[model samples]
Target chain A: MLEFIDANCRLGRGPAPREGAPNTTEEILALMDRFQVRSAVVYHASAQYAEIMASNRRLKEETRGSDRFFMQWAVLPPVWDLFPDPEALLDEMKQNGVNSVRMFPAQFGHSMKRYAAGALLDTLAAHRVPVFLPFDQIGNWDALYELCETYPDVRFVLCSPGYRCLRWLVPIMDRCPNLYVETSNFLMHNGFRLFCANMGADRLVFGSGMPEASLAAAASQLLLSDISQTEKEQIAGGNILRLLSEVAL
Target chain B: MIGENVLRGEPFKGVFIFDIHAHIDATSDFELTDSSPDKVVRTLDALGIGGACVSSILSIHADCPLGNLHVKEACSKYPGRLYGYLTVSPYDPDTDLDGAFADPHFKGMKVHAAFHRTAINDPRYEPYWEYADKKRLPVLFHAWELADVRHIAELAPRYPDAKFIIGHGAMRTWEIKREVVKAVKHNGNIFADTTVSVAYDGAIEWAASQLGADRVCYGSDIPFYDCRHVVGKVATSRLSDADKEKILGENAKKILDLP
Candidate 1:
């Protein structure tokens, strides 16, 4: 089986964790072992429900001494000095070994538009840090297209596009080279083969959407897909590995 | 035991695998990349699935006559490999399923109340429900909520001979799933499929323990979604091999009478 580095995962129990959802590091590690995930990039759910800074600090503390887990901080737009200074934040991330960041614009009640997130986006682009954006938070494809086009240097991984987003995804992907898609719920039939054929395997990354979803569903798409072994390897963990490595910060 | 094959990323061998909820062609909402019957069968062969019970996307969405024609022709082309679901339209309540049922390949009825804009228990669906009861057939519903489960619970007692399957049974929220368990527990004829894009961790295990292994069936919603991952979800669950065997194929095989 191909090794997987789950690019989308969440740590810590949310305000309303679903039944059978794993919250602790021990539980997640067991799931990882069973599902053939070598490692994972995760964010703290408390960052969504509580203060982002404190939750991110808790995430770093909780995941300390675990090489198998990589931390991804939840960031917000710098409105009313809501977040730390961009340079200072990047420096902290670099020191703490946090390479990627996720944004929850809808949940945080902020706009990812130029006026709100332009400064943060520019800083992220300068450092070459990849941003994980949920599909629902961006509202629609047009906003996503604009965000990608505006920050041509930054890498964006669109998560939870679902099985029905293919018609909308193809054109957007064609226009935005900086945009990539996670494989958690992109479950269109024969979609992996078709995507690799059209978009190249480099643009796709494997993500389990674990806890909320399972790892086997996304992992099996690459494992049983008609794509070549090398392509499968790229999608399973190679692509995300390359993205994280490109983070200059 | 079957999980060993799935864990090693190999096609399941020495066991029968059949998907009860699947579609043959593309829907209006999105393209299915390859929804042709040949491709569908090819996928089943690749995954070592013995067969799949499919309804045409066209049949449920629009054009029932033409859609049923597509299903009939596909079943003819691949005799035992593909089975047909005689999809009935709510608008055409007077539609005759007798002609469709004449062929042995036509196994059951598939109802999509969401698409047809009619409640499952509406007066128009009573005739079809009666028909399924008379034939002792399994009726698969495109149900994803508590209300749908409630409707099935109410109807299952009235139509004792007919089997009721709730498609996308693990959808939406955990509360809905708990309610689904409560409803299925009350109705012996009611069963649910482990088919949802959001295949949550331990969902298969939870469903098996709550609903009993026999009351749940394996369904992939194939072409709309792939079977491999959902198969992986069931195969790699914490449930015993016997329970996994039941969910992966045995339960569905018993329901469809496939040997």
Candidate 2:
């Protein structure tokens, strides 16, 4: 068995309640232990549906003592003056131990094209900090294509893309070297192997989408995939580790 | 990194795994990665699955009559390894259910209400349900919503002899899953399969805790989904080894009367 570093997990509560127990930090840690996940790159679920800064503060507070957890912050449009200066926000992120940032433009009611995301994307690109976007929130491949074209230096990770999105996702991988996708709900047959063949194993990251999604299923997908052991290790934890290492912050 | 070995090695090595929901032809109009029965059997062999109850995508998506022929062919090609499910659309008036069911290869019937553009409760399905009930055949519905579960709720009591295996465990929401658990609780003949439903965390455990292990069966939804990932969901779940045994093969064997 290989070590897993889940790239798409959440802490705190979302607006819509889930069926099982609340997604608390203690619960997630237990889940990580059960699934043999050594570490995780996590975002606060409240950030997806509630106030961004408050959620970020809560995430930092909850994960303060644990070295096993890597924090990912949520970003709103700069027009709201959420963070007055983009550079200052990066500095704040560094101080707070934030390794990556995520965007929920559609949920937060904003656009992520070069026009709306220009400043934030530029700053993150300069810092080499990765940006995580859900496939549904990214609108369409054209929007992603434009963003990838505009900020070629920025590492854009598409979170939990489904099997149907493969046709377009393949082309996006072909067009953008900086673009990557996380494996959580990626249930396509021979998907991991095919993705590694096309984009290289380095571009595919492991994600469990804990609480809401199965860690065992996600880990097994990469583990049992036709890809080589080295490829499995890269997808399991090495890829995300490399992405986090590249972050100047 | 050192538990059950979900990677490389056979995860269900000693376990008798029986995949209840699988397809022989293309699953969707868009793409069918490995539709050949030989490929399906090979994939199953690699993952340590003893057998699979397969339907033809041609029957579900295109022509049921033609697809059922492919089902027969797959069963003949791999005698004990592959069991057939006669795929039928209520809209296809020419569908000879009796003729298809007459084949010993076919163990049951598969209906996809979403693709057929008909509700399961529609009068058109009455004949199929009635026939299936009389034959004591297991009917696997593409049940992904509460209404689909409602369809099972409506028909299960009426045709008590027919085994109703809700496909995908009504996968869309927790509400639907609650209904599925409720339906299985109320009806002894009602069951759920672990197809696309495995994506949800604790789904199998939740289902087992709520409906008992015997009411749930392992289904790969292969070609559309993967066997390794689907089986891993059950293998790695919090359910007891005994309960896991029931879901993986024992329950299916009892339902399908497999040796």
Candidate 3:
């Protein structure tokens, strides 16, 4: 079976609940390589003050001579506030061939504002790119599902749905076709089985939230799982490829 | 907590668990960071640990004071499960013949010296050896690397009068450090438990090749680790079932003087 497309991977946490070892771009890629992962739509930690730009710049720098890797949406509070026009950054990202966005509510502690964060959403909607919302492990489903339903066109990537309330994730995604999940944290036991049963392999991807976990171990959760080979391939890499291809990132 | 590798994925009578350590205080607040005597039991049960060797809470070396009483209560109440050990602070006298010391519920003494800043070889603690020597109650020490083989070598010679166990098996680096064997030099009165890293039968084999098989005993440093995982490792080790049986069930019984 395909190991799984770990859609939810991270880099640059110097220390726990913070950024350290697996926090650097190189460390993260090495982690991904351990499990033989091909590419990831990247996001920077909340430290860089618009770390999304840092994430974008790094992806560009790393992929300058390569084609497999790409960038997602990452933004720091400062750089976002200083933007002359939000659309300009969006256009610049598009021109630079960036693909998606990653949202961090736990770090910022609230939903992206409609007017302040709203304009950015408008730009993404205009471009039809996806936004990955990582609630720092304690996600706000109400806000995320609302974003997915409201935007309809924006693809929202949710990482680490976790194990506590299994039903909580599946039902939320029911109303939002654009919402997807990344299997990164606590992927063992029953959650992987539940995801394939409900979210379907097409909507699921692999991720290791590494340094705290092993890519081979996490990927093995899916690779070793009893899912169909075709579905496994799609979850492993095809889905992300499809999503990235649509956005031209 | 224990799972039989012989029965892995085949599914049987449910997970047969034996938690080798715990301190429950169920009345205390329930949080993952710390433990209370009652909460310890519930946590063990919650984690599918069928049985445990619980220590008391609140004492000088102070480990857990009431965990044994609680485990006795649990054992009487639950049956075929739960083992309790009383706290005996080397800082405070073991009070061997006292009601708490002689209480039938407890099988042994959970003596923690390092955490409470007492020496394993201190003469002040000799009362415990004297008492254990008389009654044959095995004493479990909070041993790490404080005493090298030379020190254990010294202590074992002096404490030939009592039954003793080095807690955490010298923090399981017995092979890496050889602190356990270097100390005992085949002193039959002293035994170590595999509660941490190096307790594997691999260590047992190396020890046997050098010191022989009877030196080490198996213990699941439960609550601190996934007991099922640890037991699975032990039960499925390359060691023979006789060795497995000793580590899994018999050695502990012999050490604690359990009927």
Top DockQ model: 1
Best candidate according to TM-score: 1
Ranking by TM-score: 1, 2, 3
- The full ranking of all candidates by lDDT, starting with the best, is 1, 2, 3
Clash pairs, model 2 backbone = none
RMSD of each: 1.3, 2.0, 10.2
What are the runs in model 2 whose C-alpha is more than 4 Å off? B1-3, B7-9, B27-29, B170-172
lDDT of 2 by residue, A1-249 (tens): 678899998887765555553267887788788777899998888878777877887887777578889999998668766554688788888888998989988888887766777888888888999999888887888888887888899899998787667767778888899898888878776777667776788888899877677787887777777778899889899999999998896
Candidate 1 chain B lDDT trough over 10 residues, lowest sum: B170-179
Ranking by DockQ: 1, 2, 3
TM-score for chain B of each model, two decimals = 0.96, 0.93, 0.74
The predicted structure with the larger TM-score, 2 or 3, is 2
Candidate 3 reaches a DockQ of 0.05
Chain A TM-score across all models, in listed order = 0.96, 0.95, 0.80
- Which of candidates 1 and 2 reaches a greater TM-score? 1
Clashes of each: 0, 0, 41
With a 3 Å backbone cut-off (N, CA, C), the pairs that clash in candidate 1 are none
lDDT of 2 by residue, B115-227 (tens): 88778887888888888899899999999778999889879999999999999883447788889978998999999988873456677777788888999898988878767
